[model samples]
Target: MPYGEAMLTIARELVDKIVAHGRADHPDEACGVIAGPVGSDRPERFIPMENAERSPTFYRFDSMEQFRVWREMDDRDEEPVVIYHSHTATEAYPSRTDVSYASEPNAHYVLVSTASEDDVEFRSYRIVEGVITEEPVKIVEAYG
Candidate 1:
């Protein structure tokens, strides 16, 4: 399925980060954020991080930052609206594990695929009650 515009931007940055991290670590997964308001036209921030997991092909984001930003956003009426992850050697689609572990039905799931050898492919999905659905995203210029 094709990703919406909003997701494409997030996916792009995520792919870049993943590839850079993959190269930097040679085998570990790199994690980060695709943060912004809910249903916004563009991503507001890209928070990159070291995949503390140190796995050759896995990513585990530190939630403290997520919580901290979420709380701050809540205070200002903005929110850390999406949880994005990169698939170092997989497609730009959610895996079964992603589906099983998903807890936010109201948020978007952006995936950046670093598997494309020549280029990165990014997409977005919405998981509700274990069912995954692709939504349309509009990639607007960066915004805060």
Candidate 2:
């Protein structure tokens, strides 16, 4: 996906994994990264991270764990294609804090809302320079 007209093309399995993580975390926010080949917009690796805050409304990745994950991704020559977090009670939208912490301009910011037991809302956005632009998500069985 391009910059202006961005789209998050992810796998169904990855989506399921994210949803499961969100559900398992319950009232707390869950966060993770989907890594892929650097420059390849496809998400291939699911790297769930611990939410250091452990709060229902806010999420902050565990710093030490994040360091290790980044090192592993560097060794694998991968980049965070999607940075995801769950909202326990709110809609699948980025919070002000989330937007302020948007460090990966090229990564898709995916939000999964686990507010309802019956349904889940998954959304993707491009947060660049503090401006968030919601994008379309296309979940496929797998990448070619």
Candidate 3:
């Protein structure tokens, strides 16, 4: 499938999990990946990754940890369907750095904003060739 062709459907529980992680790591960005069976387009596994940068305005996955996680996903015949991170003080939108760092053209880039304190701003986008295109996100009860 192409990068911007399909609407991303994420389980509500998974959304909750992501939001919770964002809140837990408030003031610092939290990063993670959602792995699913290849070609499935259904995110099934939520693997919260450590923010190596640990900075409020930036996030970088730990090198060794990212390698291990990707290796594990490969071994399980899975791929990262969604690459997610939190925006501590900004809106739920990708920053210039985020666009430059996005290497997965086919993965949905989800950004959660914990800026509101009382509200969670969740949004998804597709970043390809440094261009960001917002996509619709459908929260479902479960993936079948």
Candidate 4:
């Protein structure tokens, strides 16, 4: 099926994994991609990527690592269904740079905020042509 046709349903475990990665890199943004079978619209593989910039206010995938990951995904006939990152001191929303750098119009852009000491705000959006549209995220125990 085509992407963005339905609400994104992510496994709870995957959500935890993303949150854990964010917490682990607290004070600095964490970035990664979840790959799924091409056209599946299902995020099934959690692939944590190294943030080249390693800045709390910025994130950039390591060029070599990204190339390798993309090549692997291509070999597996998969694509990035979800592109995610963390915001250490900001809201779980895309920054202007994020929107500008968004090249995956078919991928869900997920943002996690580790700014709150008591709560973590996780949100998802579709950034197409520089337009950001918030989408509902349904967390499930598993995905079949």
TM-score of each: 0.69, 0.95, 0.96, 0.96
Extract clashing residue pairs from model 2.
none
Strongest candidate by lDDT: 4
The lDDT for every candidate, in the order shown, is: 0.61, 0.91, 0.91, 0.93
lDDT of 1: 0.61
lDDT per residue as tens, model 1, 49-130? 5566777566666567657766776775554446666777767788888898777655677766666567766567778788
Cα-lDDT of candidate 2: 0.91
TM-score of 4: 0.96
Clashing pairs in 3: none
What TM-score does candidate 2 get on C-alpha atoms?
Answer: 0.95
Better of 1 and 2 by lDDT: 2
After TM-score superposition, what is the CA distance of residue 109 in candidate 2 from its true location, in Å? 0.3
Question: Which wins on lDDT, candidate 3 or candidate 4?
Answer: 4
lDDT of 3 at 34: 97
Off by over 4 Å in 4: none
Cα-based lDDT at residue 48, candidate 2: 93
Please state every model's RMSD to the true fold in angstroms.
4.4, 1.6, 1.2, 1.4
lDDT of 4 by residue, 17-131 (tens): 9999999999999999999998888899999999999899999999999999999999999999999999999999999999999999889999999999888999999998988
Query: Scored by Cα lDDT, where does model 4 land?
Result: 0.93
